[model samples]
Target: MTTLRILAAGSLRGVWPDLMAAFHHQTGLTTDTQFGPAGLLRQRIEQGERCDLFASANLHHPATLLQRGLATDTGKFTANSLSLTARRDVVTKNDTWLSLLQRDDLRLATSTPLSDPSGDYTWQLFGKIEQAYPGWGERLKQRARQLVGGIDSLAVPTGELAAQWLIDQKHADLFIGYASYAPRLIHHSHLQVFLIPAPFNIQAEYAWAMLTHSAVPLATFLSSAAAKTILRQHGFT
Candidate 1:
């Protein structure tokens, strides 16, 4: 049996294992998978890394590959939204999601833009905030510390949640990341999860691209009801 090669976004790490297992059971196909920042993975593919399929946290990366002739087809598979994860002690009784972001005394951590879709979405959220509040968005952008998700960013230890690890390590008082992580982060005794409200939040579209004809079966499987059920179970929309 030829094992399918898959490269996926780091955000999918929690769900990919189960997804691959289901894919194998249903189709009798094996897969070898790697997870990392979607943009960095796309860069690797562009540089000639071989994979049957590439799944990204945002549509842009996969679309870029299709446009550049590096992929044969690309389409969205699932969706996610942003949320704020703050250390329990850092949040005050008077704080709202917006206010926590505006406070200068608290450190704000985000993924690195251009190297991660989460960071790009955070910037997009800032843009929406800017539209609503005039200058606050740019201030948030300036204040945000790109702590992880870059080519040279600190490596999050395996089996650890990025938001939890970053906050527990004292890197930041607050982290804006995918809301899909809320279930896991909410259970942490020292963390508080806040859902970013509409008009200020950005929707992250996860897309996948076929790098070779051999990927068609896996790509098709990704869109099946079983796959969607697994995605929803893992907090994807």
Candidate 2:
């Protein structure tokens, strides 16, 4: 049986098993998935990691893959919502990050822009801080610095491990991450998401592509119904 090697974003860690099982059943091609921050995966590919499918957490990541001749565009499959999340304990009395974010003791953690699509969405949110309340971003950032060593915003690893870290360490009052990963964290930890209404929410466009070094048949199969169903079932859309 042929094998399909895929490099995907770490946020999809929760849904990977089902995606692989379904694809294998349909195509009879075994799947090997390498999940991590999109930027880190790109570095591995640049260093000559042989791969078949490229599923990324952001449109730009997939675009970059095709631009550098690393993959073929298969277009975005679905979008994930970005929002602020808090641990259940920290969120009592119907309070949310938007309401308490300006508190002198609050800290908001996000992933590094250097290696995450979620990070880009976080930065975009900072620009729209006024939508929640005027001048909120500056006030939040100032206090965040004194608590977390100094920073305008907080960043954690862009991996599934980071999800556990958030709950284990109680690192910050809130975090910005994809909805897919957020729900899974709740199952295993003390974290919960603050739902940003549609008016203030942002969607992250995700994509799947065919790696240049892959066997054409394997890459082609990723765009087939089997893969699409798997991706969609895992909340790709």
Candidate 3:
């Protein structure tokens, strides 16, 4: 039996099980997945983690890997968009960010802009909206800083971690996470998902590639038509 080791972004959590089972049962290769932030995963590889496959929420991390001679022959696939998510119970008199940002009692959470693409994209999205709507940028920025005043706050990493915190732990009243994570987001009774307006949200593209340390042929198999079908079935695109 071929054993494949995978390092992937946390956003893939909800769909990973299905993808793994199908890949293994059909190709007879068992996959061991280690999911986390794309940046964190990249750091692991840089630290010499022996992983066969690396799929990231943003292509940047993979690009970094290739630039650093850690990965090779990358392939781009799938896409995602940001959503303004919040707890359902939060009595948002405004509910939407357009209105919520101006409120005083709300707390918002997002991944780290420097380390996580989702966080970076969200910041840009918010900036875009603020540009379109006068007076939004000033208040939004202030509100963000106010919400996360603690020094040891969770510097969110991947899109999935954001959703996980909202649902699994109830860490934040509002957060911006991945589009595909919507189904899982619904599990949070107080969580409600909303899309950021066009020009405000970034168009996410998820990519996959092989690690230089790979000992298994999983990367080659992933590009096969059969594998593509399974990924597409799981909402990869």
Candidate 4:
């Protein structure tokens, strides 16, 4: 069988390797995988990069490819929600979600907005917080350090999850990212994860699309029961 090339979102890094190994075993087709910010990956494919399958953190990227005639179709395989990862003590001490984030001295970190859907969801949460608290949207935006998933993000080597790395390096007291990544973001045993509140929660949809003219039919495999089981194991709904 031919080697299949796949470009996927960074958030799926934890599970993709093992999942694809299973795929290979079942189909006898080897795959070459690349993972990065979803939007950036989409841009690369749009720029004529060769890839058989594109899996993204949001439908928008694949939908754009479909409209551009770069992909045949798109289908959602899993879904995730935004969440906060922080030091256990810090989370336990805060009585309210907004208050924790609003603390004057606390440093917050998030993926870059517009470049990564996680950052976009973080911005949406800020907007909701602004609605509830009044005058805090701009404040939150100003204080958040865009550490990953932007045009200017520090160069993270391929296959590395930047948010988890930043948290491990103690770049900030808190990080905003996909809930599926919470387990990896906790650098220590004491780190904790908090679900984004109902009002601010954004369910991130992950979708896959077969590139136009690609010989590999990965879109159908993405929807298979085996794939869904692996996604769920990685925290996707």
Which 10 consecutive residues of model 1 have the lowest summed lDDT? Answer: 194-203
Candidate 1 residue lDDT tens string, 5-71: 9999999999999999999999999999999999999999999999999999999999999999999
Question: Between the candidate structures 1 and 2, which one is better when assessed by TM-score?
Answer: 1
lDDT of 1 at 170: 90
lDDT of 4 by residue, 31-101 (tens): 88888889999989989998888999998999999999999878888999988776566664544556678
Write down the TM-score for model 2.
0.79
User: Which residue pairs overlap in candidate 4's backbone?
Assistant: none
Clashing pairs in 3: 87-190, 88-190
Q: Which stretches of candidate 1 lie over 4 Å from their true place?
A: none
Off by over 4 Å in 3: 91-94, 138-142, 145-161, 167-171, 213-217, 220-236
| Stretches > 4 Å off in candidate 2 | 130-134, 138-161, 213-236
Cα RMSD for candidates in order: 0.8, 4.3, 4.1, 2.1
Per-residue C-alpha lDDT of model 2 across residues 28-94, encoded as one tens digit per residue: 7687888777877777887899887777778777777788887765566556887566766766696
Q: Pick the candidate with the highest TM-score.
A: 1
Q: Estimate each model's TM-score.
A: 0.98, 0.79, 0.79, 0.90
Alpha carbon lDDT at 78, candidate 2: 56
| lDDT (Cα) of model 4 | 0.81
Ranking by lDDT: 1, 4, 3, 2
What would the per-residue lDDT of candidate 3 be over residues 1-237, giving only the tens digit for each residue?
Answer: 557788887777767787677667766778888877677777878998888889888878888888888887687756778876776776555566556555567676666665566766667777776788876765665555311212344545444345556434656567766676665666666667776676676888777768754533556555567766766665455
